[model samples]
Target: MATAIGMVELTSIARGIETCDYMVKAAQVDLLRSSTVCPGKYMIIVGGETGDVRAAMAEGIKRGGELVVDTLMLPNVHEQLIPAISMTNQVDVRGAVGVLEFYSIASAIIAADVAAKAANITLIEVRTGYAIGGKGFVTLTGDVGAVRAAVEAARKDAELLVETTVIPRPDKKLFDALL
Candidate 1:
């Protein structure tokens, strides 16, 4: 089976979430919205089927323009799928799913809690850290897909609220060790 992946770089984190909600409802597709906001930029990823995927990307552009986005980024649309467990499957997954780095502990906790709720995980352990300066990191665990979603949600939640960086775990060692 082929799945369409649509990635839209938006002007603001809030607008990105709004655009995603609009696209999801308009296309009537079961989709997930994840965002990462760096300094002066926001990148949002919305994935689903090809046809609707394209349309959703278009909607994002439209919304961004209407919102007077200072920088309207070109939407990147693609199609890809992997043989992974669905969110419905109750599998005890263990690994470093995703980590959202924040500038403050308050922001980190806020993002972590939001991600946990979105992912439907009860026991979410949020680790706070200051690598060198006063940067904080929030790590969420649980089902693979859920953890990914949670991380994205956390990023979106923290974008404007604080200065942060969201990092998804491509390697599972660190997360596995913690477990």
Candidate 2:
């Protein structure tokens, strides 16, 4: 069930994976066949010996972090991200920590959106408000765990581009106010 065959020759097989209907047919033969979902974007398939695959996976995760920052502008903005939890019967979380950049609402919103999806949450809404330092904040909401994970993923994704901090849900009053 391995996705990749060991020591594949760099010929038609690699090229076929890049552009060929047979790639899909081959997948039908085995769903585990190593394939890149979004080549050159968030995903890439680099094949070699078993050891190479291991290193590639690690590098992929690392590169993903780099992509997150490139896509989300972190510098020149006061950014603070946290999970927003709901106290309703669903007990669901529906937003992410506000991502601020250059005090530009649009950029902050984009960061929040990218962070939200990376964390696997539905972006319910994006709201802007004042931070403690008079800096602007863009708050996003979605599933609780997704929001938490997204924040983490966003940080990892932007590891090279920016530094980030995680803020857990605050007091009941504040949570209620945001909801």
Candidate 3:
């Protein structure tokens, strides 16, 4: 149910937490996540109406100041994006599977949104830098052609890309570890 979402990555954990508090107080928004990632990076994600998210983002960036590393705001976010990030989207591992990995969380989230909008696909997961050494990755499944197209579209927008691949037919056992 997220219409607009904003994210801020900071170099300081304390600044990031303080920014999150002020951001929520600045606007009516949902605090999707606010925690330290790998390598001592801190992240904050908020979602709500466009205006509200915008205000919250402004406050967060201002508070983050020199500690800010990266930020992104999606005004018309894809419907599948939130579910994927929350690990709530359900779908079988059908057809081809595409994967996108990035060095930044914002790039991975952006790739997920772009992929969802570019083709008919089911998002498997939109994983952020939690315990993965400050890396982000996205997974989706669809027909081979659609998966390929979606991956290409997402790649063009991805920043700090680490790797990308598409499997025409992934062994089902591989999904066990991914899930």
lDDT of 1 by residue, 9-105 (tens): 5556677677767767666445543444444344444455667667776777777665423321122221111101012222265544566666643
Candidate closest to the true structure, highest TM-score: 3
Question: Candidate 2 on 65-149: residue-level lDDT in tens?
Answer: 3332122212221112222211122226534443323232223344554575565554323332223221123344455566667
Ranking by TM-score: 3, 1, 2
Best by lDDT: 3
Model 2, stretches more than 4 Å misplaced? Answer: 1-102, 122-125, 128-136, 141-145, 155-165
Per-residue lDDT tens digits of candidate 3, residues 1-179? 34998999999998889999999999999888888999998999988888999999999999999999999999899988888888888886477889999988999999999999999998999888999999999999999999999999999867899999999988889766566
Error at 69, model 3, angstroms? 1.4
lDDT preference between candidates 1 and 3, better one: 3
Model 1 poorest 10 in a row by lDDT: 78-87
Q: Candidates' lDDT values, in order? A: 0.48, 0.34, 0.91
Instruction: List where candidate 1 sits over 4 angstroms from the true fold.
Output: 66-179
Between 2 and 3, whose lDDT is larger?
Answer: 3
TM-score against truth, every candidate: 0.38, 0.32, 0.92
lDDT of 1 at 12: 66
